[model samples]
Target: MSRIAIVSDIHSNLEALVAVMRDIEAKRVKKIYCLGDLIGYGPNPNEVIDIARDNFEFVIKGNHDEAVAYKIPKRFKRLAAKAAFWTRREIKPRKRPGYREQRVRWQFVHKMPRSEQLGTWLMAHGCPTSNLEYIHDNETALQVFANEMGGSRICFLGHTHVPGIFTMDGGEVHYMEPQDGKRYAVTAERAIINVGSVGQPRDGDPRACWVLARSDGTFSFRRVKYNVDAVAERIYREKGLHTSLGDRLFVGE
Candidate 1:
């Protein structure tokens, strides 16, 4: 009856996060784990952080979260850089009356770990070791499985915003595409699971996606539709924010 809900890349889309949480609660999951990117790209960074702090039991730091807390890497594209800078101010505005409260929220993300080990499972925003790396393809996923030294046989990750699975067996790597409502059995082969994005999905699907991992060594991907237009409209209304950020929500980029 107990299940661990794995979520990631929320990207400050409150509407999508709310819908995903609703579906997660409906499934009666006991513990929720977030793989990070709680803010960035969207309009509601503080709201997403508050929900993440309140709901998720385990949280790992994401690249966007790092960019906001620390320095934006040179590798970051223009849009992401812009969003990170905007979020930095939005969370802890210079002349805001509630600076203390905003600082607390920012500190929450700063306190998150780059990776967490839970028994046989490893959770990270990107790869197990690097929060900025993207384990989207089989080669990259296999590299992490081989390089990372940890007891966890399974690694749950996010960052590319596309849900999929990679298995390492007998030194060979294979990738699996997940289906909604279908459970895939976890084998002795080490695996890396991408839970996709809760806010902005980039796999050509606009729905919010998360992973439902049971204690019995099986997991499933779930997608839920939310009010993309509402969030997009809100993004458009916010000044100093990119309009394309709102437009991409409708297309899932």
Candidate 2:
């Protein structure tokens, strides 16, 4: 139960990812797990995938990951669907100098599991029941704890892009907004933690968000500031990516 770092919803933002990785390294964290959404909504799908493939311990499949890798039905909203489609075209294998490497990266995303269980903890992009499902409230967290957790004490997930802690004790659930760098002890019978988004954070904070979980039953949320303007400019230059995507990064909406 060594300390581990969890990151999610990278959304192909290379600047943010690099910044988070640097912070993780500075903290001397060894094992890193990704909750997914490795691609989509940004300018560097291939580059981001390459880093995840090379560094992460494992990456669970997210809704965007499933859509981009398989070209499945576009179930996302208008803007998200457009980004996924654009990402699909951008990451598709082509006759290039690194064709073999490109194919390997595509396969990595294709083979990602919807969920992974590690000892008493479960890791998923969204929820254990489905990758598309989001646990944004106490009711959803309670339902997941009662039905879907499958006896795990803690469930780590990301998809809402907002970092928070949900604890179920004696059939009552409580939600808390995790403050940056504060380690909250997990004393509840069951808990669900959202590690938040590395690329796109919706908690009104423009900085990247991640979590550091320790073996002592405590975890801390971390925020790292990166060059958002660099990523936004890249998105603006790419005709396939909507400008709204760039604009949201500034406000973290």
Candidate 3:
């Protein structure tokens, strides 16, 4: 089976991204798919972009990424807006190198569709229709599944930062704990898998979010432990980053 890694929401935590990559390497995975938000809410935004540009096979844009390339309006949650603003400043030429490179990639942010369907599998950062929607729970899944249900047998989603599986088996929903690196075979029924957050987790779990897909339509989920303290300290040290962002690393909320 050819396993490809699915990573999302690194949010500029280089330590976490590196740790997750180590986990991927240990599994011998080289092909990677990114669900966006590589920069935001933490340090080393450029480093995250560098690694992704060098490694990822497919990438979708996240709301935070779009906010940076385009102007984020006041309608966005102020906290998120603040983080995007701070992240843009932090990744500037003086603070972070590779701004031009990142910007070149950032320009593609707007072009990323809200969702992607590859044969039997679909991929998206949030809901199929909205990049900013949060598919965190079963209710959200029900609505999204109903809309995107088609020939595609499975859908992979992120942006909720809570890793879990929501399966539509004969019009019923069953939620499973994220697969711990073992592919869970799928039937003809549809499924929506939230890949979770890599740098920052919010499912009362501090580990990073991940997913693995094989050529034969088999897939798995992985959440690896990284240096949370290192990420927390960096955010705390950054002048413009809010304390709440740093403090959440401990709670994963």
Q: Which predicted model would earn the best TM-score?
A: 2
Per-residue alpha-carbon lDDT of candidate 2 for residues 98-165, written as tens digits (9 for 90 to 100)? 88987888889899998899999999988997889889999899899999999899999999999999
Every model's Cα RMSD, please? Answer: 1.3, 1.1, 2.4
Tens-place lDDT digits, model 1, residues 87-144: 8888964556877778779789789888888888888888877888888787887788
Q: Against the hidden true structure, what lDDT does model 3 obtain?
A: 0.78
Candidate No. with top lDDT:
2
Give the better candidate number (2 or 3) by TM-score.
Answer: 2
TM-score result, candidate 3: 0.89
TM-score of candidate 1 to 2 decimals: 0.96
TM-scores for the candidates: 0.96, 0.97, 0.89
What's the lDDT for residue 58 in model 2? 92
Residue 137 in candidate 2, Cα distance off native in Å? 0.8
Candidate 3 residue-wise lDDT, 1-253, digit = tens: 5678988888988888898899899878868888877777887776787787788876788888878767886677777788888877755444356657756555554465556677777788877777788876778788877885566677787887888888887778888886566777777378887888898889888888788777777788887888888888888888778878889988888
Model 3, stretches more than 4 Å misplaced? Answer: 92-113
